[model samples]
Target: MNNNNALLIIDMQQEDGFVLEHFDSTVNNIAALLDTARQQRVPVIYTRHINQADGSDMPRGEPRAADGGPSSYRAGTRQVEILERLAPRADELIVDKGRYSAFHRTDLDARLKALRVETLIVSGVLTDVCVLSSVLDAFALGYHVRLVSDACTTTTLAGHYSSLLIMANWVYALEILTCAQCLHALCDRAYVSLAPQQPDQFAHQPHELENTIARLHSHLVRTQE
Candidate 1:
């Protein structure tokens, strides 16, 4: 991976947000991505969604009310804590947010700029909500985005896939890949140089290139399933 790239794990907290299909698998994949980022010396940033003690900070008409109440993400509560499986190191950053997008009402953009990060590798929960929101904001902030499709999940399969498609189409042209492919592209020096551009140049012939593309397509489909 390039030094200018950072992994942004958004809202992977212990809240009711993770009660969805493939949640466990997504967590496991995110853990693997974290390990790869550490091995490659890439920076990792985590975001936790927390509201005020009295729920005054939550947005108007937010779904928190339907999910029991606005007290879910109360500060210092266990629901607002990041999952232990993908805990951040002492040196890593942990940005507390009150909204769906990590960049909203947070120093995320300033911190990434301070680190000279040009590309963000995004992974986390509620693919149709926080992940999508953050991805759009990152694009608008002039940062390239690479989403780990396998390392994110939503309340439903349709929501997850639709979010990915929307980000890739309407929001911005993001590089969407599975966690395994992302790890491979980041850790393998040769692959890193060819990926996101000139991937065909790495293949000798048309058949070889077709096969490579087919493999990646299959991986994406399987991850969604």
Candidate 2:
């Protein structure tokens, strides 16, 4: 990953915002990556889900319409608050986005461009929806996209896995990596210490990783040749 890359933490808000069973698991890893991003002085941008009628702040029929209703966490609602685990610090940019793509109707691209960011590291919930939509847009907008597989979750396992398959199989230059791999790449270290939700959540460490990055190297190697 280049130093000019920015880490985009998409829509990881309160429980109502994410609505996933394994929400904590995803948040934990995203926070871990954010930690590395901070330590490395990488530009970090947090995208908040907005709504029109309390759903998403961008009103319906507007240029930037979001598919889902205004999540309770959007804007003034408590639901819009970034989960404490991966909350942004004062220096980071908090982008308000009504659409799936952060660049749609938002100044995300401009902000990144101003920072001279050429690559984007993406993580968030609803793997097949918001995450995929934003990543595809990032790719088209000329940013190298890297999806943090373990740091993103969906309401269903099938949808989550399916998105990963599609991203890995077809999206050229869009890489799928585990939170660990990404963290290490940013930190330039071999061992990454995860910021778990609780001290007892150790069991989730490797188990959660196995499904995200373990197979990516082999897949990438084959695709490269």
Candidate 3:
């Protein structure tokens, strides 16, 4: 995934917190990642899981509940709210899902295709379930997937770490990276874009301007040296 990519944060809602408490740390790192994406003008999409009442479980709906527990996670519920740590921008898109995969029963794929997004940086809860499902679908659809290893979690330590190992080994198109590495790649790309190329195109306006500014900085450095 290059600069023209988008970051997909899935099931990063309060409901998942009921199952995993480590979301606090993961969410903080995710906030940093989101901030970096915003600074680089990369699109960010947040997915919230919604469940209908029918004697379902907390997430997928099982068949044992008296007070309509499933409906508690419906759209706009406090549990489904995006965590405050990763504040979504006014223009950022938020998709509501009823199933494990964010793309299922959601316009996520169509929206990504419309934006010409080819690479997806996937991060979120239920590492073995939702995250894995979404990442696998992304690979099937030919989108390069980068999993933010630290920004995902499961209820238990084994489930969380094992998911990373599996994806790293078997997922060819998927790369496992930390938030910092991804941010560095984006920063490197920005520097590459600022470097001079096709001198004629920049010459008339600010070709000399770059050199002039560089020379002034060089002279100041010499004085200090």
Candidate 4:
């Protein structure tokens, strides 16, 4: 536990382009995490996936609006704004990114370096996309990454868990915990995180998705002492 920890919320903008699994619950969990972070005086950083209003920064082969604008997270639109409930304060850092990874073509790394943030507590939408990309990049950039499982989601549960498994399998010292556990960890309380205990902790075939998810959930829950 240290003061070098920061919370990284990724792609939780108001874009309604896709329906996420457990979105409401995810938002609630993120809210809780935000509350704890602020109370703990931990730095909070938010990312907005804003594309060029004229579609100039749209990813290659991305779907386009009939009017030729970026389909989602259009710059200058409300959709590109962070959720009002979880909006950052004036002193917080807000990073606007045109790509999935917050570190991609953005000053996120530089800012984190300036803040001397060594660990990142990650949560947000599109778990398999932006969140996943951001977590991987964070790891590559030499920051300790912790994920709040319930605070992140994708269009489907399968995508969400699969991404978690992928990261757990390869992120090296990744720590995957639930929202409650994350809150406890922030407070320097006893909390459990499913860190890499062994190689391929979640290794499985595609058909083992359900079983793997069960195993993952097992790590996220607190058992009777």
- Decreasing lDDT order of the candidates: 4, 1, 2, 3
Tens digits of per-residue lDDT, candidate 1, 1-225, equal 356889999888888844687988999999998998998999999999888776667788765654445757777679888888988899999999989999998999999999899989999978999999999999899998888888998888767766665565554446787777788767864222112343232233545644554555464766443
Q: Please write out the lDDT profile of model 3 over residues 1-225, one tens digit for every residue.
A: 334689999877766435674777888878888888888888899998877555343544343346665644565468778777776779999998877888887899999998889889888888988998898788788888877766888887657655654555456676566666666655653211111123222222334554543443343234322
lDDT per residue for candidate 2 within 1-225, as digits (tens), equals 345778999888774733575777788888888888887889889987766554435455644325454434445677777888777889889998777777888988888888899878889877888888888788778888878777888987657766766566555657666776787668765532222233232122445645554344345334322
Give residue 129's error in model 4 in angstroms. Answer: 0.2
Q: What tens-digit string does per-residue lDDT give for candidate 4 at 1-225?
A: 245899999888888889888899999999999999999999999999888878887878987899888887889999989999898899988998888899999999998888889889999978899999999999999999988899999998889988999999999858998898899889988977888877787899878889998888776775212
Candidate 3: global Cα-lDDT?
Answer: 0.70
- lDDT accuracy of residue 145 in candidate 4: 93
Worst 10 residues of 3 by lDDT: 190-199
- C-alpha lDDT of all candidate models, in order: 0.79, 0.71, 0.70, 0.88
Candidate that would win on TM-score: 4
Q: Cα RMSDs of all predictions? A: 7.1, 9.5, 14.9, 1.6
TM-score of each: 0.82, 0.75, 0.75, 0.95
- Residue 190 of candidate 3: its Cα lDDT? 23
- Candidate 4: C-alpha RMSD to true structure equals 1.6
lDDT of 2 at 78: 71
In model 4, which regions exceed 4 Å deviation? Answer: 223-225
Off by over 4 Å in 1: 63-69, 189-219, 222-225
